[model samples]
Target chain A: MKALNRYARAVAELLVLFALYALGTWLAQALGWPIPGGVVGLALLLLVFALNGLKPAHLQLGAGLLMAEMLLFFIPALMSLLDYGALVRQQGLRILLVIAISTVVVMLVTAFTVDAVFRWRMRRDT
Target chain B: MTLEPMPLAWLGLTLLAYLGSRWLYRRTRIYVLSPLILVPALLLAIAAPLHTRYAEYSADTHWLMAVLGPVTVAFAVPIWQQRALLVRHWAALLLGMLAGSLASMLSSWWLARWLALDPAVALSLVPRSITTPFAMPLARDLGGVPEMTAVFVMFTGVFGAMLGGVLLRWLPLRSPLARGALFGVGAHGAGVSRAQEVGREEGTVAGLVMVLTGLLNLFAAPVLERFF
Candidate 1:
């Protein structure tokens, strides 16, 4: 009975989340906004939380469940590889090289730049 | 065997394979064994021999995709939890993310052009640094192939998550904020996940940066298209 109640609550929380996302999608479509509905939904959720319209606990269970299984959502994208076999074969190495080098460069640049800026600010203040 | 029943079967297979792969990743903690890498490989292996079409598999697994919106929105909870940190370092974080995001876009454009990729393909590569949800629409707006943008975004995330640690070690970064910003800017969702594993502060800052950078890129994409 306890487990059943918990499951029911989870379902209810998930429903609320889905409804908010749907509303966000509707708003974005109605406005013809270029931003994705999911992001608009994120903005809405952030506003609601900031204004204390909903406590974190209200969405915690559902959000936690989704975050824990987030990787599952991406599997389809990876699976779509089957459709891109030819493209991958033709330009796979080149694409990989660009992604690899850029990722490292971005990481190094961002990290070091931020670190440098923060240290420089501290030194100036001191 | 029936066509109508196949979606359910495929869904079950996805779940089982993910669970098995996740268990192996947990037991070994090997980066390559991570579920993100392994499950897809496992699916591709099964898919080829079984004659499973990507379209069919995707249609069957659309329910999982549907949850992505909510999952993206759900990220707000974590970001909200880090509101204090965001408020304190808003200037630094924002500047860092903006620089990082621009660097990612410019570098990708330069490399794609240098490599002489198709113009459309090069355009798709421009938004590779942003999270997929935002990157897809941005790519579409810029006349790039959204699907190809998704692939680049995923590859960027995986590479950032996999190599970010090794690269960070060689850098002179001692601050969690700087490290987190790097991961979030370079990696998107996967890098944020990796950041979370490192420390709470790192994860929180990374998540905040990821959200902010993604939102920033939405506005920046149009401006970027003019150059590329």
Candidate 2:
């Protein structure tokens, strides 16, 4: 009974999230906002949390599952590469090289910069 | 559109491949076996042999992509809960996002010249690090195909997620703040999920950073258009 109840709660929470996403999508379309509906919905949820209207636990199970399996959502987009034939044939290897090298450099620079700034603050606080 | 027989089969195959890959990754702890790399590679290999068209495959599985929107919204929960930590690390987070976004655009531009890529292709490549929603508009305004830009964004994201962990091992990142920001800044959307596996703090911080990175790029894109 308890496990079933927990499952039900997660489904309910997911539905709530889905509702917000739909509302945000509609609002963006209706208002001609430059932002995506997902972002608008995120802002709404942020407002709710900021106002103490909900806690993390309220959406924990559902959100956790959604996020953990998030890679599943991205595979389709990556698979779209199959469509760009001529472009791929000509620039595929080169583009991949550029992206690969740059992504590594960007990750390193960002991580080091953040670490340095964090340490500087720590030293000041001390 | 409704789920037709072919797309439905493709969808089921996607799910099975991902689940199987996830299991292999857990069992063997191989980086390549992770869903980010394995599932896409598996599907793409199968797709080519079957002579599947991109349009049909994309249209059939469109709903999966649509679900990304709600999953993105779902990020708000962790971001809200992690407000306290975020406040404390504001300075680092801000600087890191700025540096990361600039590095991404600049590196693409710098490297594109060596590749001798056409001007338009180069522009699309520049915004590859930003999420598609923001990157597409930037690409369009800058005389690149938004569709091509989407593909580049996907490639960068998948690569970033793959590299984030490998990079972590090499860096002496001591805080969840540092570790999480690495993925968020470097990888964007896909990185957030990768960070979640690291820990809740890392996940929350990554969620916060990815959204902030998107907004930062969106704002800077206008100033960038003039320069491009």
Top TM-score: which candidate number? 1
Q: How many residue pairs clash in each candidate?
A: 0, 0
C-alpha positional error of residue A103 in candidate 1 after TM-score superposition, expressed in Å: 0.7
- List where candidate 2 sits over 4 angstroms from the true fold: B1-7, B130-154, B161-176, B189-204, B219-227
lDDT of 1: 0.83
Ten residues in sequence with the least summed lDDT for candidate 2 chain B: B1-10
Candidate 1 deviation (Cα RMSD): 2.2
DockQ of 2: 0.63
Can you list the residue pairs that collide in candidate 2?
Answer: none
Best by DockQ: 1
lDDT at B216, model 2: 77
lDDT of each: 0.83, 0.81
lDDT of 2 by residue, B107-207 (tens): 99889988898787898888888766556656876778776777788778778888898888888987788888888888877788789888988877887
TM-scores computed on chain B for all candidates: 0.89, 0.78
